[model samples]
Target chain A: MSFHEKSNLAVLALLTLVFGVYFLWLMPQMAVADPLPPPAAVAGVLIPFVLCLVVLIGVVHLVFKLRDLKEKGEADERDRLIETRAEARAGFMLALGVFGALTLLLAGAAPFWIANALLGALVLAELVKGVLRAIAYRRS
Target chain B: MGKGKTRIANSIREQRFHAGEMTQQQLADAVGVTRQTVIAMEQGRYSPSLEVAFRVARVFGKPLEEVFSYEDEA
Candidate 1:
């Protein structure tokens, strides 16, 4: 795999693990919590989640850079093309996610649920982009 | 419209052999692409842009048509 492919795989794995744990913890609370969790309470989990994601991604890139010190990290034409294609598809995923979030709002869902839905959509879009990129790299 | 698989074929491997067994990395560096791009071209899994195709041919001192060819699916 090229450096970009390796980096993509690492990020994909990280997003899966981080968000997987988050949703697992949050989903159970959604059913039982009366009045739903406050935004501050969600932020309690989200703040840490964002922090961990940012730190871990930084570490991943740092390791990759260390492993390939000579690499200038410049993306070539092929990399740009693959990324553009993946983003194009992922854009549709985001739109669908946003539509779902809007639907939840119209149905009188809790703000907590609507917020999480939007977050889920964003994360899912990113995951789809990563998967598409990986596939493009493997097949082409 | 339905998309068809890439039908562009290249003789990068053969040309590399003729060019003193040039490494994929060398060709990629010379043509300003990644080595995986070079590999994809050699395996006929990817079709490069016209500029890249020209660059690759230039590196081997061959005409563009000599390096890459297209096949009609019909």
Candidate 2:
């Protein structure tokens, strides 16, 4: 796998874990009836997010370890071709998310709500495609 | 662009191999592609441009039809 694909995979994993924690633990515990838990940043969430970020950065370096400060020939023709195609697909995902959000805004949704919705959708699509690309590259 | 059973001409590569082996990377270098690209072509993961295809034949001092062939698949 190329560095581009590896970075995408790490980001996808991080997004899923963080969002899953939000839905399963933080939001549910806050919405519980008995005792409204004080909002606290879970060490669990923070740790994994930070760790994933650090590891992603590390992997990016590892992927480009050779070459130079001016890294040429880090990727061959096939890598470049695959990357271009993947980016085009990811861009379509972003565009679709933005279009849906704009439709909501036109229907009189709160501007902030629309913005948040758009951001969430974009992140989800980005994560999913990153994962799919990783799979596609392997299968290819 | 299309994926199907295609016949590949392996003879030019065979002719280039005086020692019975020619590294894919060496041909890729002469054809201005990466070794990964060569692997893709060999594995049918990608198809090269017409110019690159011709260059690949030239690298082995063979004609294009001798380097690649066409086949119909069901």
Candidate 3:
């Protein structure tokens, strides 16, 4: 697999772990708390998100150092093909997410919810596409 | 994805060889693309944009037709 593809995989795994921890397991548990109060502040989640970003950057960079950049030739025909397909798939995912965002807006959803939802969808689509590309490259 | 065929494959290949067995990287640097893009052109796996194609021909000091020819099979 190309270095780019490997990084993409790492990013997807990072996102999945973060999402599971914050959304599924932790958020649910928080909602069940006694006399559950609203979130401490809008910025409370910023720390975790920043930490996740740092972890992602550190992990991928450590995994694929510049020493691996010396692959004798230009990425061969196979690499090009893989890149083309990966890019196309990712583009479609973005388009789909954007389309969903449009529908929600047309339905008169709250502006804040519409914007945040669209952003989340974009992030998720990117995560899925990265994972898909990495898996495909590894298999090949 | 196969939109248009390259017409000057042979000429481009020959010029690259004549210019001291020019490596793809060297040509790519001259033509303003990544080495991978140059390799694609050399192998006939891609058809570059007209601007790039013109740049490539100019690099060889040849008319565009001198480097490329049309072939139905390709």
How would the candidate models be sorted by TM-score, starting from the highest?
1, 2, 3
Q: Compared with the true structure, what per-residue lDDT tens digits does model 2 show for residues B1-74?
A: 22442355344446447525778767766788766557667766566677878988888777888877775564
Please identify which of the two predictions, 1 or 2, would achieve the higher lDDT against the true structure. Answer: 1
Interface Cα root-mean-square deviation for all models: 4.3, 3.5, 8.2
TM-score of 2: 0.63
* CA shift of A73, model 3, Å: 17
| Number of the top-ranking candidate, with DockQ as the measure | 1
Locate the minimum summed-lDDT window of 10 residues in model 3 chain B.
B1-10
Candidate 3 residue pairs that clash? B7-B68, B7-B69, B8-B68, B11-B67
Interface RMSD for model 3 amounts to 8.2
Query: Which of the numbered candidates is closest to the native, going by highest TM-score?
Result: 1
Clashing pairs in 1: none
lDDT string, candidate 1, A16-133, tens digits: 9999988887656664788788767887878898899989999999999999886667788878889999999999999999999999999999888888999999999999999999
Name the best candidate (by lDDT).
Answer: 1
Give the winner by lDDT: 2 or 3. 3
The C-alpha stretches of model 1 lying farther than 4 A from their native spots are B1-5
